[model samples]
Target chain A: MAFNILIVDDSKTIRSVIKKTLEIAEIPVGELYEAENGQAGLAVLQENWIDIVFADINMPVMTGIEMIEKMNADNLLEKTPVIIVSTEGSQTRVEELIKKGVRAFIRKPISPETLRNVVNEVMGDYDEGGN
Target chain B: MKEETKDIVYKVCCDVFEHLAFMFGEVLDEDDITSVADTFIKASMSFKGEQQSGIVAIVVPEELSVNLAYEILGLEKSEQIDPDGPEDAVKEVLNTICGRLLPAIFGDSPIFDLTPPETTVISYQEWEELVQGHAYISLEIENNPVLITTSL
Candidate 1:
């Protein structure tokens, strides 16, 4: 089965890389959408049924954290899992993201194996590697 | 002058280079570290945290930049690579690298402040002139030199 996916990042390069990595990993995707910031990501959510959203933490116009908080407040983020894709490496920050109901967090420059593992697990595959 | 700052700078450069190489699958080696070339792709980003405003600069050779553009765009190198279009790419690499480095150096949440990356095409002499007062470290990525200059 294929799933709809949204990628939100301010960097075109990183978005391209993530898309490429997904393709290389052979993740089943029905649609691939991109947004440059949190607001844009929210706009996409209004129109599409996204199974997973990959977002960066910092950006102009809107940030990932703000986006998540807004989505939660508006009740638009229920059931839809968001995974923070950022370079931030702090336990407290990651905990904050977890408290905000993020499904998972992946650091930048993620390997294909890890990327695959995250998506698979979120889709309820329950991969042992992800654990 | 602090050990924390020194460690962060070194790690940032190493991490940024490794990330680029991994993403592009291209070979980046440092050929020369002393002087930059006449043609290069330069990116800059401002860091704002705890009453301090500093800048980070990453400069790569034009050849490498063009190559990276092609790799990024997922097009053949024979295709015309738009030099202007990759400015955002430059900025992004700088932003991520700096964002990660700040906390390591400052031992804080890196403040809620940072600027979008600004990039420009620069000449060797121009870069030399710009580095006069600021502290800098240069790396030879697969023989292609990348100079990182910072003003704190």
Candidate 2:
């Protein structure tokens, strides 16, 4: 089953790079969506059926943490996986995010291999067409 | 800044450029600093940690900025690029560099709050003024001068 993914970042270049990386990694994507910040990401989430979300930490209007908080407040959205794709590298911050329902954290300059591995690890058995 | 700190910033700058844009950079000798181009782009961002707070900035020639954008986007030489591509690319580069540099300097335990990166286009004369006032780490990437500075 192809997964519907949402990418949230302030930089258009980064959003494009992540999309390119997902394509290069050959990850099966059902419907890929883009948002410039966390507020917009939440709007997309509310409007679409997203399997997973890739978000950056620092953004204008709202932050990734804030978006996650909003997601956690909802019953259905809380179950959806969120993997952080950011330049942030603090272990403390990582732990904090994990505690806040973040599935995984990926640093910037992400490689195709890393993305593939993270996807497989987070969405296990999905590769075999399992939801 | 101390020489050791400068060394760390320099190393981080080189590594980020190579990893993010597939561009290799070498440490530029101080004496070799010369006006190679009249136009330049400067990207800067601030960070606040528990014990340290400061700003990190990067300056690159306009020509190099375009190259950075193209390489980062994995575009061909003939492909057209958006006008905002170069500016966005440089800002992202600085953002990545700042993120990595903080961890390298202060370890992974200290969480940092980083401001969104800001960019500006400056003339060579303005660049010269900045060079004279700040202690910056210079690098040569694609034979163009790149500068990184930190203000604590």
Candidate 3:
């Protein structure tokens, strides 16, 4: 079964690349939604169901970490795994995100295999026959 | 701040290009590296450690930058690559490399902070006239040339 996914980043290029990567990787996609920043991402979340979110840590409007913080504070961290896809590779930064309930960290220039692995690992039984 | 800073930067370039080439399914050549800053993509990131501030600027070619982005984002050629992206693809490459490399150079678990990457396009004319004698490292990965310039 395909899953609904949301991608959040300020870069249209990055977003387009991700969408294409998912398609190329043959990840099942029911419906794909995109937001340029955290606020828009949250709005999309409220409006539709998203199984996972691939986000960049650094953004103009609202950062990925800030968004996760808000989500956790509001008890909305459940039901979706937000994997941080970014260039920041500091260990401290990674640990901080882990504490906030982030599923995993995939640094920039991410690979197809890594993306697939993370999605599958996080979604687990929900994917219903892994894509 | 020593004369070896150039060597350090060069080593960093070699190490990073080798790793990136392996990751991108290609091995880079030294001949492909170009020092001409005009065709470079300018990227800057700030690092703070021990009350000392370091800024890393990576100047890369547009095509190479796009290719790196493709490798990073895993996109096909059909997808258009934008030179203007917030992720600062090339800059992020420099930032991550430096962030990892600097500590090893410092030989300590120093608290280093990184800022987001910022990038821009640079023309050859401007590069020759303005960026005079700037320190940069050039490399060829699978015959693809990559350049990096830093201001610390």
Candidate 4:
């Protein structure tokens, strides 16, 4: 089964690159939704059934952590895995996110293989038949 | 900062260009980037943390940014890239570099909040004057001149 994914980041360029990376990684994708900031991301979440969320930590209107906090509060959306795709590299911050229920963290300048592996681990394989 | 620390900054700049832009670059010895080029775009970002607070900036040549956008977007030659693609590319690249550089220099414990990148189009004359007294390193990417700077 293919996965419907949402990417939240302020930079259009970064968002585009991520969509391309998933394609390059050959992950089966059902639908791809994008939002510029965390507030917009929450709206997307409410409207669509997203399997996974890839978000950046720093944004103007709302930060990724804030969005995650809201999601954790919502019982309906709490189970959806959130993978932080950010420039944040501090161990302390990363630990905080993990403690708050983030599934994984992938730093900036992310690679295709790394993205694929993390997604597969969190959402299960898209192809289903193969690893 | 020591001379070696500056070298690490240059190395990190090279890594970002190579990894994100899929291009290679070498550091240049120059005080002013404007003296070397006429038209370019600049992107800057700031980071605030307990250990340090500073800014990082990158100036890229117009044509190189176009090539980088095309590479990053993975579009065919026939598909035209966006008009502001170059500026946005520089900004994103700056964002990536700043995120990586902080951890590389200060270890993994410092938690910093980064600001989204802000980009501008400026002439060499403006760039040369704007970067005065800043600690910076210039690089050559695909025979095009680019400059990276840091201020603490």
Q: Pick the candidate with the highest TM-score.
A: 2
RMSD value for candidate 4 = 3.1
Error of 2 at A96 (Å): 0.8
Q: For each candidate, how many residue pairs have backbone atoms clashing (under 3 Å)?
A: 12, 0, 7, 0
User: Model 2: residues >4 Å from true position, as ranges?
Assistant: A125-131
Model 4 Cα lDDT, one tens digit per residue, A10-29? 88888989998999999999
Residues A50-116 of candidate 1 have per-residue lDDT tens digits of: 8889999878899999999888887656658888888775567788888998889998766689899
- Candidate whose DockQ is highest: 2
How much lDDT does each candidate structure score?
A: 0.73, 0.91, 0.68, 0.84
lDDT string, candidate 3, A75-119, tens digits: 554546788987664677788888888888887556678788887
Ranking by lDDT: 2, 4, 1, 3
Instruction: Mark the 10 consecutive residues where model 1 chain A has the least summed lDDT.
Output: A122-131
TM-score for each of the candidates = 0.81, 0.96, 0.74, 0.92
Q: Could you give the fnat of all candidates in order?
A: 0.32, 0.88, 0.16, 0.92
Give the Cα-based TM-score of candidate 3 against the true structure. 0.74
- lDDT by residue (tens digit), candidate 2, B25-61: 8999877877679999999999998899999999999
> For candidate 4, what is the lDDT?
0.84
Tell me the interface RMSD of every candidate, in Å.
Answer: 2.9, 0.6, 3.9, 1.0
Backbone clash tally (model 1) = 12
Model 3: docking quality category: incorrect
Better of 1 and 2 by TM-score: 2
User: How many pairs in model 2 have backbone atoms within 3 A of each other, for residues 3 or more apart or on separate chains, i.e. clashes?
Assistant: 0
